[model samples]
Target: MNFLYEKITFIFDPLHHFWEHEKLSRKISIMLVLFFVLSLLAIEAKRLGILTGPLFSFVPTNHFYAISAAFTVVLILEVISLVFTLPCSFSRSVGKQFEILSLILLRNAFKELSKFPEPLTFHGNQEAVLRILSDGFGALLVFGLLGCYYLVQTKAAEKAMRPTDLYAFVAAKKGIALTLLGIFIYMGLHSLTATLAGREHTDFLHQFYTVLILTDILLVLISQCFQPSFYAVFRNSGFALSTLIIRIALAAPPYYNVLLGLAAAIFAILLTLTSSRLFGKK
Candidate 1:
């Protein structure tokens, strides 16, 4: 077990540090700007028939799609960040998920922009505008609620575990997180390939959330090994259920999606408060 823990740590620690580095974030920000500008120019070129051939085939010819593309890249970065949060306390990890959920909502709002005409006429844009409103406000609501979730969090439950058991639980989660990173890469590459092969839409994020649900369930079960107490198990399981709701929200239609996301966030907040109240006193 020690050997396995060391191996996982050796792989995860450096990668996490590099991923969290300020330099990398700056580089990615610059790249996102370049990507957005290049995408707009390329899209305009495609629209004007100046760019030809299969390389540009998958690229949409709308300038608004550039915004969507930028948001997609941002969402990908957020999901990568989410994967690194897996080794933390369940509540903290779930909080991170809520963060991503808000971003996803914002992304959906940007995606709705693609439906607008180039000159941005209001005619026939009512439904699209309403969808945008739903997504934008939904994102804001989730973002605000996330602050509450963090504010109510206490370390008492986590501190209740024995040191050795806590160590084992953390190591186990680290291994799982490392494995999740691998799966994330594979899914991303697969999605890209499928898109390049002319698949109109690949629901890559949705597929990944499905995998996350399974991972959350595994995490809940793994917590049983080190902290078999009722409160601990129930709390972890409730977090997992919250993740499942988030997954469902990804598939739901616009208004329904917003409602589900809010529901998930509220459920998580209530769960945290209940667990903290029940077990934190001891």
Candidate 2:
């Protein structure tokens, strides 16, 4: 228990102690949410086709764009997303990561039961994962750029660029590291699901989940620029506003298209609130 406690503390220590209670509270709240969502997923596992249709359409599976054009679009999206999202505290920053991960995990489980009703084809899953990796790299780039931008923006950051700013510099570095760890965990989980489950032979769970994750990465990137501004609004009594936007964007007429919508609105709201506080005051 002591070892586990140390591990947990270390994972969270990068965040300030002022945020300790908030993080623990959020962890519990998210756990409850995980339970409810997994329950829904277990039920939806019986109806797979509807679930996978959305994921397939979300990814340009055929690879139509030129490599350069494709790369540019991804780069732009990541930069825009991170430009808006990076300012919210580390714990707040990762909310969208949880949201997207939750959605993909559930969606993939459903895809497993429906699409490959016959034999498992796990290698097929790699296609979606590959696209997500491409996007994730774009996200890493954006986060990298934003970290530098924020470092320069900080008073301590701008003061000297000295050895002592090293603490703040390290804080920014930890943020980047945490974000990367999330991506690695996502990939590892995707692979593990296919390999450990009998579906390893026939499952495309990895593929669909990967594509969805790219969208998740984008959402988090966007939060970097605006999370603070938006949260101020939320705490001021904008209860349903954020949820409404997310729901509207996610409601893909026929189904929610991962790449085409605001799949992670909560982060957007907090991000917007945070950015406004910093940049919009009178």
Candidate 3:
């Protein structure tokens, strides 16, 4: 375990180190943006038959699908940012996760547009219409819930944390973030290689949430060191439960999946708001 921990630290330490340096961080961000743009152009060219390669066939031809795919990449970056924020404020991190999930739903809604028939009438594509409606509604609802969470969080009382404890918490969270980064790299490469090799590629969101669930569990365990009250524990656990619900939604049928995801967000927000009111009043 010690060896594994050291290896993870070695791999992820550079990310934390670079993030501390403003110039280096900005350069990395610009590089990522350039890469994303180049990827989109390459995929577009492949679709247009201007480029010939084994990967061309896998590239999404529809403009809507291509745009949605790009947004999914952005969502992944947002989740990475959330992971980095976990050590500082758990509530804020949870809020960021909610935002990412909502964006994922929005991306799905965009993807649904690609499924619509060319004429795009309501009669022939009822199923697609339902999917679009469900996804769009779910995205809007989650965004509203996120706004409420932010408000509740701002009004909530701050926990008194010792400087030493804060340092320890940040260090532990950084290690976990590095481990998560490693897992993400492995999963992404595995999925891409499998797809290119003609094997079944794993569902990206499903695999990601599975890893996220484990990370959330680790975070909850880490939170135990701060001697939080019962409500705080409950709230954190609720966030984990919310993530699980979203993961389960990924496997459900179209409309049902959106409904389930929205319900989870609603439940989480209500729980947090109630807890804040009760605990903050004391």
On lDDT, the leading prediction is 1
Better of 1 and 3 by TM-score: 1
- Model 1 is weakest, by summed lDDT over 10 consecutive residues, at 154-163
Q: What's the true lDDT of residue 9 in model 2?
A: 41
TM-score of each: 0.97, 0.25, 0.81
Best by TM-score: 1
lDDT tens digits by residue: candidate 1, 109-184: 9999899988888889999999999999999999999998888885334547788777778888989998898999
After aligning candidate 1 to the native by TM-score, how far in Å is the CA of 21 from where it should be?
1.0
At residue 59, candidate 1 shows an lDDT of 80
Q: Write the per-residue lDDT of candidate 2 for residues 113-179, one digit (tens) a residue.
A: 3333234456666655544443444334334433443333342111123454334434443455456
**Alpha-carbon shift of residue 59 in model 3 (angstroms):** 2.7
Candidate 2 has its poorest 10 consecutive residues by lDDT at 59-68
When 1 and 2 are scored with TM-score, the better candidate is 1
Span of ten consecutive residues with least summed lDDT in model 3: 1-10
| Clash count, candidate 2 | 33
